[model samples]
Target chain A: MISIRELHKSFGPLQVLTGVSLAIESGKITAILGPNGSGKTTLIKSILGLVKPDRGVIQIGEQVLNGDCRYREDIGYMPQIGHYPENLSLNDVMTMLQDLRGGKHPTDTQLLEKFRLGKEMDKALGTLSGGTRQKVSAVLAMLFNPKILILDEPTSGLDPVASSIFKDALIEERAAGKTIILTSHIMSEVEELADAVVFLLDGKIRFHGSPTEILQNTSESNLERGIARMMQEAVHP
Target chain B: MRTTGKIIKYEIRDIARSKFVLFYFVFFLLLTEGLLRFGGGSTKTLISLSNVVLLVIPLMAIIFGAMYLYHSREFTELLLTQPVNRHQLFRGLYLGLAVPLALSYGAGLGLPFLLHGFNAEGDVALLLVMIGSGIFLTFIFTAIAFWISVTYNERVKGLGFSIVLWLFFAVIYDGLVLLVVAWFADYPLEKAVIGFTILNPLDLARILLLLQMDASALMGYTGAVFQRFFGSFWGISIATVALVGWTAIPFWLGLRRFAQKDF
Candidate 1:
């Protein structure tokens, strides 16, 4: 479980996160939905300790995430763009991660096999297509079998088959009781895997509850329409 | 230390795999060997090579180091999310970068010297000084570039700053120093001149190389004064210390910025 309290972050005049406090429970895929420039990525990065919050506190389980970085051991983060050293092949990336992570623990290679990255491990990251690179990112995120996985735009570049494969993997991880916090613009994907939903707009949490609740409140049947309706209210309000 | 080692291992692996370092290695080897082969008067060629090192090494270090740090940023960000110390990560990266540059400078220029018959009293000390100064410049400028990369959010801005920094030390600084000295001709400015030279790593490196080559005639008024003041051993020591200081301070500043920076 992760808890953030009164987190306020600003980039110059633009306030990305404004007094947003959230507690994400374990064993659920919490899909953080937001519009462009809505601070969803900032919020996620803040939790991953990638973006330092200007104010407030974050706690993972019971330990306060301050200057100590050891807690990040439990986190596997798949960055949005997944830029890596262009010279290095996929195997080099895997080895580099293994080395940087230090000490040998059990690593999940299932995702690698699922993506069939083993055959293409010799290919340099620069040569890979965007979707392939995303698959690499996904594999790295799931490899460590971290208790918390923070995936940014997890399926943006994936093909239908790869995306479905990824979704199935997420479901499996959820079944294994891992806390998954993912940000995606894809509502159908969110509808498929997200156990609970957290909607953010203008650096504030607009809605946080079950997907059905959002549908009921907005008088819509499906998630896409419900979210659209919610956005409509925001625009008018 | 173990984690630092592991990081360095992978980091070096990454750098070595890149074409940048390899290109550097080949360029230096061909240039050095080519000079040795065609250019008559080995000593003159060595002196000219020293001049080349003085001008080119710092520039290469700045461009390469800045580009590497900026490009490796995504890799750095990914590592940030892992359970690793920032200080160690930076130290590892610093060493990872510095080591290859040093090795390439050594071997590229070095193999030529060995092939041409190296000696302790003959051309060996001069070659050693060239290699040493080259290494120092690499470390110093790379540290500066690292600072630039970490301190700026935008890569273009960071690289721009790095270029300006390289220009200031390599070209502009000496001209400005000459202008200042000429302006203050009536003032007792030897100490001030030496102080200003110490402030710039390229100047310090130039002095080290020039003195090693015993070509102080080319060093101008301050070089003679520098020789008189510090003598040989003390001069080398002071210059070496200055170069070390230049390397350490910027790297430390860069490390501090990196530790505090958000991805």
Candidate 2:
């Protein structure tokens, strides 16, 4: 479980996250929905300890989020855009990561094979297309089989078939009792996967409940319209 | 330790495949041949060859090494989130860069020695002093590069500052020291000159190596003073200790700053 309390952060004079408090349960898929510039990414990075919060405490299980804590060991992060060294081949990257992790992990060939990346192992990362790069990032994140997965724009560049493949893998991950936190603007994608929805607007939590409950609160028939109406109301109010 | 070794291996591999390293090796090979032919390959050509290693190589190493460290900050930040400490990261980077330094210099200097059959049973102590002083000079510059890279987030700024520092060490430093000595010529300034030499790794390296070469007699009054102060075994030992300080101080500061950096 992930717990954040009274989190406050600012970049210079621009306040990003203010008294942000939330809990993410294990074995559940939570969709963090927010309009652009609404602190979604900030919150994620703060939890990852990449961004320091001015005033707050974050806990992953019993361990607090400190510089030395190995809470990161159980967490896998898929950045919004994955950047790799231009000359690095896929296999080279995998081997390097494997070695860096000290060969402690079981061989994770399933994700590579599933994504059809085995054939492209020798190709340079710079030569790969955006979709292919995303596939590689996705594969690396899941390869370690971490108990917590934090993915930002996880399916942004995927084709429909690849998207299906990703969705299936996420579902399997959830079934195996992993905590999955995903951020995406695609309402349909969120609706299809989210067990709980946390809607954020202007760095504030506008709504937090089941997806059905969120839709009901906005009195909308569709997830997209519900999200739009909620955001609009949050702004106007 | 295992993870640190892995980081070191990958860093070395990355540097080994760099275009600049390849181009540098090729260019140095051609340049060495041209310069040797121009000098007609004489021991009297120490000035030209010394300028290559002293002035040119240090300049290039500072720029390329600083740029490499700065350009990889984001990647380093990613690694920090893993199960690795700051000291381990620093150890890996230092070791990784040191490998390429030793190999490239070995190739550059060794090639000429091989072709010319450069053989001399010079003082063993002085020979060891020369090699130690040269490598220590490289270490000091590399540490300076790493420190600048960590202090500045922008690659261009890092490279710019590092180049300026290298220029100061390579040329301006000696010029300023000459002016000071000229201004104070009447007093006993031998100790002051020795202290000034300790301030710059390049000077320390030159003094150590020149003592080994036949050109020590040609360095005039300043050379005589250095020979008097640093001619003994204990004197060279003191200079080596000072050179080690040149490496350790900058490196320790750089590692400390990098450990505390948010990224």
Candidate 3:
């Protein structure tokens, strides 16, 4: 389980996250839903220790993040726009990452085979298409069989088929008792996959519950309408 | 330590594969070869090579180092998410850049001189000083570039700062020193001039090589004063320490900032 308390962050005068306290349970899929500039990425990055918070305590399992990086060993992260070394081929990148991670764990190449990326492994990352690169990101995220998976917009550039493959992979990982946190704009995807939802607005958590609770609270039939209603209410209220 | 080594290995491989680094190697190789072939004899060639090395190596190291940092930001971000210590990563990145550039420079100049044998013992000493100065300038400027790159997020700003810094050290600093000399012509300025030279890494390097070459005669009255001060064992030791300071101060500052940087 991962927990954060009183998390705060700012870029210059622009505040990105404010007093965000959240506890993400293990063996579940949690979706962080927020509009643009709502601090979802900042929150995620803070948890990953990529962006240091101004004030907060983040604990992952039994380890507390006090500027130590070993906590990230159990976590796998997929960036929204995966920017890798342009000169390295897909195979080279994979090998380099494996080498960096120490190759101590038994590797998981299921997603690599499932996405049929072996044929394109020799191609340079710079030359690959967006969808192909997204697939590569997905493959690397699961390669270590990490205990926690944090995916930022995991399906943005994927085609319909690739998207389904990715969603299935997420499901399989969740079923295997891994904690998963993902951010997405696709309501249908969230409705289908997310076991819990945390809605953030203006750098604060406005709502956190199951999809049914959010729908019932907003008096809406679908997850999209419920979130829209919440956004509208916050803006006008 | 092991992790730092792995990071350095990957970073060196990445830099070595770039066409620009290859171009840098070739540019130095050809320039050194041309100077050796047509530039009169060994002493004259050494003089010309020192001038070129003193000017070009700093500019190349600063510009290339800053540009490489900016270009590889994505890869940097990717690494940050992994289970790697930031200090080790920073050291790896810095050394990965400095080592190859320094090697290329040393080899580029060293190769041609090896082919054309040294005529005199003094010529051999002068050549070593020139190569040593070039390597020092490379490390010093690359560290400064890393500091600038880390401090500024915008590429244009970081690059502009790097170029301006190079211009200051290579050109403007000399102009300013000359102006100071002209203004203070009536005063005893030998000690003051040495102090000013120590302030700039480029000047320190130039004087180190020029004093070794015994070309202090061309520098007028000040040259004799410089030879008296800088030609001694104590003078050389002081200048070497200053060069080391030039390389360390910027790199230390850059590393501190890197550890605190959000990205």
Best by lDDT: 3
Candidate 1 TM-score, true structure as reference = 0.92
Ranking, lDDT, top scorer first: 3, 1, 2
lDDT tens digits, residues B1-263, model 2?
A: 76678888888888877766666666655665666567664353444656566776678767777977876664576576555767788878877886577556656554654576433445334334444555676677888889899888887888889988988988898799899989998998999888888888887677666666647565545455777876745555766788889889999999988776654
- Candidate 1 chain A: worst-modelled 10 consecutive residues by lDDT: A97-106
In candidate 1 the C-alpha lDDT for residue A207 amounts to: 92
TM-score of chain A as modeled in candidate 3: 0.98
Q: Can you give the DockQ of every candidate in the order shown? A: 0.67, 0.39, 0.78
Ranking according to DockQ, highest score first: 3, 1, 2
- Compared with the true structure, what per-residue lDDT tens digits does model 1 show for residues B1-263? 88888888888878877777888888889988888888855676687798789888889998889888888887787688788888888998888998898898889988876787642364777888888889999998989889888888788998888889888888898899899999999999989989988998988888887777776779776677778889988888998998899989999899999887877
* Model 1 CAPRI quality: medium
Clashing pairs in 3: none
Better of 2 and 3 by DockQ: 3
Candidate 2 lDDT, A85-167, residue by residue in tens: 77788888778766777778765567678889877889998899999999988887776778999998899999999999999
**Which runs of model 3 end up more than 4 angstroms from their true locations?**
B219-226
Q: Taking the tens digit of each residue's C-alpha lDDT, what string does model 3 give over B31-111? A: 878887887677888877777888899999999999999998978888888898889889989998999899888888888
Model 2 ranges with Cα > 4 A deviation: A8-15, A52-55, A199-207, A233-236, B19-48, B70-81, B111-119, B123-128, B181-195, B214-231
- Candidates 1 and 2 compared: the better one by lDDT is 1
